[model samples]
Target: MPIDDVSAGHRQELRRGTVALACLLRLRRPDYGYALLEALAADGIDVDANTLYPLLRRLEKQGLVTSEWSTGETRPRKFYRTSDDGERLARDLTQDWYRLDAALRGVIDQGES
Candidate 1:
């Protein structure tokens, strides 16, 4: 049976924070918004392009990412990479993610058993 709308919405909302972390980690390699969106979805972190574009802009504004237009390509695309500060933040956040993952797994396992 399908998850109810409230459960699905809550699940999506909880994923938003992880999506930011995923983008920061994945975009250590330069990528445009669409490519990053595809990569995230491929990795089972499905996020909409509309949401990603704005989040990228916000990250840039907050000095967590750097971006440039790739004029070398036939179609100019803006590519973004994690800035030095972003990399540092990602490292720290990754540690926290591991802790959170462990804690959540314990809770899930308890529910299962």
Candidate 2:
């Protein structure tokens, strides 16, 4: 397999979990699907609508998020926000991410020694 293809596979695997975590963090404030997608992109989390929509549905089903429809606009939009459970999960995940980052940095530093 080409090295680029190998790297791409690994990158996708790494990003899979991070995307969920990023969505949880970002949805602390209510936002519609498209707005959430744009905000995530602005924050450097590139996720496709195909991926995000399903993820949102799953999160809502899991009680990690809640949604309500806004009918005031000409086009009604479903806005989502993180639930209490999701907030807790986000905090825990953020701590784990920090721990993992530090551990990885230590490994790299040791390798450089």
Q: Which structure among the candidates has the greatest TM-score?
A: 2
TM-score list, all predictions: 0.89, 0.95
lDDT of each: 0.92, 0.95
* Candidate 2, run of 10 with poorest lDDT: 11-20
Q: Flag clash pairs in model 2.
A: none
**How many angstroms is residue 72 displaced in model 1 relative to the true structure, after the best TM-score fit?**
1.2
Write the residue-wise lDDT of candidate 1 on 27-77 in tens digits. 999999888988998999989888999999999999999999999988999
Q: Which parts of model 1 have CA positions greater than 4 angstroms off?
A: 1-3, 111-113
TM-score of model 1 vs. true structure: 0.89
lDDT of 2 by residue, 1-113 (tens): 99999999899888899999999999999999999999999999989899999999999999999999999998999999999999999999999999999999999999999
